[model samples]
Target: MEIGSFDAADASLKFGAAAEEAALNTNVVVVGSLERLRDAKDCHKLQRVLEASPDKMQLITSVARAMSAKKDGASARELYLLPEPVETDERSGSVRRVCLIALPSACSRHNSPARPHALTSCLKGNAGPGSLTVVAMLDDPSLAFATGCAIVRAFPTWVAQSSTAAKMQSKKINVIFDAPDNEAIPEAEIAVLSWAARAIRFTARLVDVPCNILNTTEFVNQARVVHALLQSTLQARGEEANAVSLEVITGEDLAAQGFGGLYGVGKAAAHPPALAILKYYPPGTSAADQATIMVGKGIVYDTGGLSLKGKTGMPGMKKDMGGAGGLLGTFRAAVGAGVPKKPLYCLLCLAENAIGPLATRPDDVHTFYSGLTVEINNTDAEGRLVLSDGLAFAA
Candidate 1:
């Protein structure tokens, strides 16, 4: 999956004014707030940007108006098939699909203007072997980053497919941010959005992959890649002094270092557990500066240890490491954008809570890095144990 952007000049050259050339085999999705789509002026400007035919424009506007009349304040979306099929290259065939997504007027206090959940829902399963262009109508330029993040979340990278199908799944995704009145988004913002999309997809892919493929060892290896990239980036900018450093304490070493919480939970797993730490020091002034530390619970898979989860509860346990994945992605993005001014530390408490003879029992007692002794009550409550070890190490 690729998430990219096109400037006004580039878009005009590729898509043309009326999408005559690009619309043939491409899937196009137009997304915006319901209130904006209801306004005649705003909707007309968007139509001109997409170069939609008069009939298609009418269909889109009518749908938006009807949705607005519901007065229920629920988000709505609709897909329209093009009347004519557009031809593609000799290899792939033609396809004609268009989706219009409208966000609700009502928003919770924390979520305004854009609702990521609604947007992701609208984009799910829209992928194919062809190209997809998303025209996001935004009231503010900064929303473009959020839009990119949401778009990537809808298309996760992990999938179980045959080699032939996997080869055919590679698709092109382009995002065009059209502000109010069809205003052009800046080039710098577009670049940032692209990077953000990449990071988001990276995180989502980690969460989507199964435990067999992405175990504790694999997670540590992935973090090492990010660490190396950050180091290289800092070196390229002539700020080698700010190079990132990584430390890994695994298996028996964790137990030896008093990380009993982490070692206890993962001792029974095939792959030994680990505590991976990444440290980033700014270019200058570090010893006296206060550092910001982040801890992530990277439970590769949770089978509930001795207190096993039921069939219904164990299926989606692959996503237990979401916290670690998110932090790793964010750290990579932050460093890629620019070195931060403050010292930063990221700790990944990685483990797999598998039930076996070596697994922690309900009566087991363990001492954490903080020297606090905890009596095991429920082995299923493993996330807090790893998190406690990470926090103690950070302190």
Candidate 2:
């Protein structure tokens, strides 16, 4: 899947202003907060792409107006299908469908505005293999990044078979941000949003893959790929020395280095366990500079070890590495946007808690990086073991 952006002028030319013919065979969906949809200027800019079909435009406007009149607790989203397929030029041989969606105004105490979640749900099946153009109306420019991230989440990139892979391989999603009062979003902000979307999709894909295909070794390889990409990017900017650096300690080396917690949990798996560390030292840093450290539990899969979980409880243990995946994505996104002013460290304590003859049984004792000993009571409690080593290393 690919995500690109369009400024207001570019959107006008590409969608409707420059030519009488609408974009051929495209699916256009416009999304906005309740306040933005009610604003005259925001609504006008959002509907600009539909100018060729005034009847369809009128239908969408009527629905929006009707929604505006409803009580505060009304449904968070409303989708309206165009009454007729948009006319197209002969060479294209297809017509277009337009959809309009309104996001919720209310936000819960524990959540940000409901717009991002609502938008993601509304876009799920709508973003198939064909071309899709999303016109998003934002009250604040920063929401553009959230909107992009949400859209990427709607289209995940994991499929089991080769035949189904094609369905997930290629998709084109174009986003145009229409700010309140028709203000233009800065080019720099758009670039950041694009990188964020890329990172989000990358992380989601890693989490979606099963442990059989994405074991401890494959996870390390994936981290290396991100490291290599970061190096290339820094090299292009003539700041190669500022790039993030990676280090891996695996197999017996983990035990030799006194990482008994990590080594013990993963010793039984077919693949050996590992601890991967990534460090970023900005230029001109000194000993006086404060450092930030993040540690993630990268259990490739958890079978609860000898104290095993029931079949119903173990179905999705492959997602045990979500913390690591999320941290990796955040690190990549932060570096891509710009180097941090402070020093940064990311520690991925990777292991697979598979049951085997070598597995840590109940009452087993293991020493951690902090020189502390812990007795294994419930083997399913392995996440804390790996995390303890990572935190001790960070300290």
Candidate 3:
């Protein structure tokens, strides 16, 4: 209906009388599948139009036509639309620049002339442009990466601060739907990957910053900004939440929890150790799906202790909370991405490793919140101690 000459041989004849009528009046939609690709012999038809068009390539026109004629969803739009070739062999003079788009669900079910293999076969393939987005039945519904994450890479450019992670992002592709609705899940999975890309990038930057710039208070303030987005009830409390909650505990409160590791580590710093907790419960879900308790070890800076590490070990110590960074990442994912209705609890324990007059001495004995006793062993191997308490609490 948008243009004219949409009728391809198969579609032109198969469309119910009504679709047939519409095809007669449309040009952009060539109501057929592979058959329509044959309209232009050699280079004068569709391929020529592709090589010489202004809008470049738009699938909408093609999709509408395919939809009108195919009896089933087989007519679902699948093809390539690339700004440049994805694969090429110069010696064979084979050059292909088009991006690929395929239906993973349907394609994975494809049968050869006589046999059908596993879906893994398709996924393991080169994954040409059209092949990346896919229909996935995620076995786990908790973590984003557990389900799948979208990774993207922008382009080639040299910058003093560029990271390998950033470079990986540039060439990144997305995972298809993994949603509540069976049909929409794959697409939803893809959408969440896109969302995480936007949200996680900022988190990476925040975690990468030096401790001097990003402190416990700063972390709390930023959390306030994020909480304001949905304007859900906020908490910096020490108790369970009514629904959505956030809590920060420190000093005597931590001591009462029997968190000796946290206390001992902080005795050396000007500020006491603080445990930040965030929780979100969805009314829609009766039983939380594999509720995950994510804990981040936010040691702002590490000077090692009685057995201090060299500068080389402490260089990127700013990211010592990388574990916590990942937790915050999961927390934000639960909030930003369309996480399935579930309760998520996050704990970010922050402290600074400083040499103080009251600093913990070598061989100091301490007990974790779980009542696990540990020898001062080594001062810097602190991430594991804090996480033990966090894990015990979460468990």
Candidate 4:
């Protein structure tokens, strides 16, 4: 699933502004609290419908009471559908039918970040692929952004692993944030929210692919794609052409340059290993005299090398490169969002540890890029070997 595929917008919309109308005309309209519905500016019209029957009135009251006592972040209450749409306002216009989902306190405890996994259960059947409106009653844009991230996180449908590779598919759910009409939503906040959502989704997809589909060569290509995206994004802003560059070193180049740790760990794999570097030079500087470096382990798949892994231990080896995936995602988003006026560097150490005649043995002692000799007591500890070279390069 591609994160950037979704659309999100925060606008000057009131709390529960369309709840009554949406309940009668749309599929779903989510709200954070019951007070939003009970104390809405147009609640009288909704009150009349909710009070039409004693049972319905009791249900509404019960929900309000339950939500009032809810302390944990974002717990779901009983679902309620209104019998009719609210009386039309010439200024407000027509409303669509929707199911109202009320979330209790979200991130109210010590400013803790909202976790999408915690709230996924509450959102399962109520919201679907199309359009989802997250009404932030508290007037916190970060809350709205958090809620949007959760929505995107829970909405994507995963498929079974396949022999033939293809890009991950997402439903492209549209999310809208309804803030208080008096409040104004900032464009920068929206951009950050969108970028965050996309970056997370991109990382998840990267870690999910199998080693064959995302090996050393393929992973370097992926890094290159992020590099191109950063360059293009910078160029589109009319930035200097030399601002961003991506450099890759692999195979003989790694060995010749004394990257023994990296070369030894990956020499046995079908695809040659590589070290990918993404460099961002701020405007007006042609040289990167001193730069901050971020290093990531890109072990595409770990088969325990000469040490060998049991069947149970080998299944999820594809996710071994998670550090690299996260680094690339962050690099792409940070550059797109505009980095600080300093040289920024991201280094990826890419490799795959497989069993073969050419693989390094447990007793092998190899000299690393740092001029340190490491005795390979066990080849299963290859991640450290690759990282040793990466750390040396960064130093």
Span of 10 residues, lowest total lDDT, candidate 1: 1-10
lDDT tens readout by residue for model 4, 245-290: 8899999899999999999999999998899988888776545477
C-alpha lDDT values of all predictions: 0.72, 0.72, 0.48, 0.66
Judge candidate 1 at residue 373 and give its lDDT: 99
Q: What's the best-to-worst order under TM-score?
A: 2, 1, 4, 3
Q: lDDT (0-100) at residue 169 of candidate 4?
A: 46
Task: Give the per-residue lDDT of model 1 (tens digit) for 284-363.
Answer: 74746898888999999999999889999999999999999998888877766664688888899999999888999998
RMSD of each: 6.0, 5.6, 14.9, 6.5
Measured on C-alpha atoms, candidate 2 has an lDDT of 0.72
lDDT: worst 10-residue window of model 4: 5-14
Write model 2 residue lDDT over 121-143, tens digit each, in one string: 76785554455667776777667
True-structure lDDT of candidate 4: 0.66
lDDT of 3 by residue, 278-342 (tens): 77766554334666567788777778866678867868777776666666756765665547466
Error of 2 at 108 (Å): 0.9
TM-score, prediction 4: 0.76
> In angstroms, how far off is 220's CA in candidate 4?
1.3
